[model samples]
Target: MADLIKRIQQGERITITNRDAPVADLVPSASGTEQQTLDAIAAIKNARAGTITHAEFVAMHAKGRR
Candidate 1:
C-alpha cells in the first residue's frame, strides 16, 4: 500500500486487491474538493455523450481563456 501511494504521487494508477480478488483502483490524488469532483463528473458525462466536433471543442476551450 505504501508503494501504491508512491506510484499515485508520481501520477500512476494502482490496483488494490483484497484476499487476491480485485476490488479497487487507486488513481492519482485529486485536490478532493466537491467542485473538483463535480467538474470531473461533468466532464466525463460530456465526453461520453460524444457529440461535440473537434473544432467546436477547440473553440470553446479557447473562448474560456478569454
Candidate 2:
C-alpha cells in the first residue's frame, strides 16, 4: 500500500482490478487550496531550466524509471 501511494505521488495512475477487469482507479487527488496550487506551480517553474511539453515530461519520467 505504501509503494502504491508512492507511485501515485510520482504521477502514476493505478487501476484496481478484480477478476482481471478494471474496477477502479487510484489517482492523485486534484483538490488543493489556491495558494497550494500556486505554490506548486512556482516550485515547478523554479526547478526546471526550460519549458517541456506533456509528451516530453512523460518521456522523461519513463526514462527515469528504467
Candidate 3:
C-alpha cells in the first residue's frame, strides 16, 4: 500500500481491482503549490455557483415523483 501511495505521489495513477475487474482507483489527492490549491478551490466554487440547495433538490425530487 505504501508503494502504491508513493507511486501515486510521483504522479502515477493506480487502479484497484477485484477478481481482475477494476473496482476503484488510487490516485493522489490535490497537492501542489499554494496557488494551485487556491485555483482548485476557486474552480470548485465557480462550478457550484449554479447548483441548487438541498431543499431545492428535495422539492424537485418530490415533484418528479408526482
Candidate 4:
C-alpha cells in the first residue's frame, strides 16, 4: 500500500493488515548508520560459511552445565 510505504520512509512503525487481520510489520530496518548494516551483513555471511558439530558448539558454551 502507498500509505505503508510512506510511513516506512518517514521512519514510523506500522502494522500491515490483510483481510482485516494484522499480518506483518512495516518498520525501519535498523537504527544505525550504513556502516552498521554492512558490518552486520558481513558477520552473518561469515558465520553461515562454517559448520560446527553439535558437541563442539555445546562444549564451547556449556560451562560444564550439561
Which is superior by TM-score, 2 or 4? 2
- Alpha carbon lDDT of each predicted model: 0.70, 0.73, 0.68, 0.64
Candidate 3, residue 39: how far the Cα is off, in Å: 12
Q: Given candidate 2, what's the lDDT at residue 31?
A: 61
Estimate, for each residue in 1-66, the C-alpha lDDT of model 4 and write its tens digit.
897777676567898689999998877667543665676565556546655555655654463352
Clashing residue pairs, backbone N/CA/C < 3 A, model 1: none
**Candidate 4: residue 6 lDDT (0-100):** 71
- The order by descending TM-score is 2, 3, 1, 4
Q: Model 1: how far is 27 from its true place, Å?
A: 1.0
Over 4 Å off in model 2, which ranges? Answer: 32-37, 43-66
Question: Cα lDDT of model 2 overall?
Answer: 0.73
Compose the digit string of candidate 2's lDDT tens values, residues 11-58: 689999999999999887776335556865764684495677777667
Instruction: Tell me each candidate's TM-score.
Output: 0.36, 0.52, 0.45, 0.35
Q: Give the lDDT ranking, best first.
A: 2, 1, 3, 4
lDDT, candidate 3, 1-66, per-residue tens = 788877886667788899999999877676543555686566557547956677765665574463
What's the C-alpha lDDT at position 6 in model 1?
76
User: Compared with the true structure, what per-residue lDDT tens digits does model 1 show for residues 1-66?
Assistant: 687777776567777899999999988756644565686577657767986678866775675464
The whole-model C-alpha lDDT of candidate 3 against the native structure comes to 0.68
